[model samples]
Target: MPAADQNATPPGFGITLDTAAAEPRVVVTGELDLLTSPQLQEALAGLIADENSRRVVADLTGVTFFDSSALNVVLHAQRQAGERDVELAVVPSPAVSRVIELTGVAEHLSVADDPRP
Candidate 1:
């Protein structure tokens, strides 16, 4: 029997912060699962905690995979943003849209088709 390749690399994951725009944006890319969700949660928490932050845009358009753990992070962030009187908008990619639609979280979250007006 052949064994799996030990040198195989895992899917790439990244998070970037962009505050140049009027609204602070967190741009996420690559796969998002239980292992990577915490990074996302932390990023969102930081933005929501900031007193100067009035609005935040989570640009998940580059994400290739979004699992239930990722969904939970987003939902938690949304709730925190609300409590802080901050607006949270999510720009989902096609891959993410399917999960949001199937989970019916679109109504609870501020889902935007585009990042800009």
Candidate 2:
């Protein structure tokens, strides 16, 4: 997919889980903004509900935008993961990282900057 496709919407964002990783991982691509946050939460729920998967690594390599609504979902997921004693790691896109850092969400998200493309 081209970079142009990532900023555009329901068509862009996608989540895929890789259970084969040793730790269950979720691949997050495209925009996770106001319009797409719910989808992210839904996808996260599918993994968070499973008791067997403790470590959740979110790969935000292709994400280009971030919003407070998306922050809510990530915070919610982090809280749930905390309650379950599941380790949560977020590989945030630089854009997303900057937003989180500026908004004080950096503390809540166990985030890394500029991951693989």
Candidate 3:
């Protein structure tokens, strides 16, 4: 069999993780959709599994796009965290804040400003 292209990106277009935790903080910056949702999913899974982490903050400042699939991923993460008795915050960027508000999911999330440098 032929070897697959190594440099080529995976099925997802743009999905990356940046862990910024000063004691307790998880900043995720990237686009999440049908393709890249798994990355976020994995992060959420890891957080909820950690008993010491009481809060999980998702920094969406770098994300310029949003869709139903992305929303679903977040919602699922919310539920997962809730089940584990953890708090989930959605730190929406100025760009994505309006869309999240319009979608009516903002109320449920702990909407905060992006603390990016």
Clashes of each: 0, 0, 0
Which residue pairs overlap in candidate 3's backbone?
A: none
Pairwise lDDT winner, candidates 1 and 2 = 1
Whichever of 2 and 3 has more lDDT, that candidate is: 2
Tens-digit per-residue lDDT, 56-106, candidate 3:
777776676666777787888888888888887777765568677788887
TM-score of 3: 0.73
Question: Which prediction has more favorable TM-score, 2 or 3?
Answer: 2
Estimate, for each residue in 2-61, the C-alpha lDDT of model 2 and write its tens digit.
455533557677878787777777788888887788877876776777889787787777
lDDT (tens digit, per residue) of candidate 1 on 18-53: 877888889999988887788889899998899999
Error of 1 at 42 (Å): 0.5
lDDT of 1: 0.90
**lDDT accuracy of residue 89 in candidate 1:** 94
Candidate 1: list runs displaced more than 4 Å: 1-10
TM-score, every prediction: 0.88, 0.81, 0.73
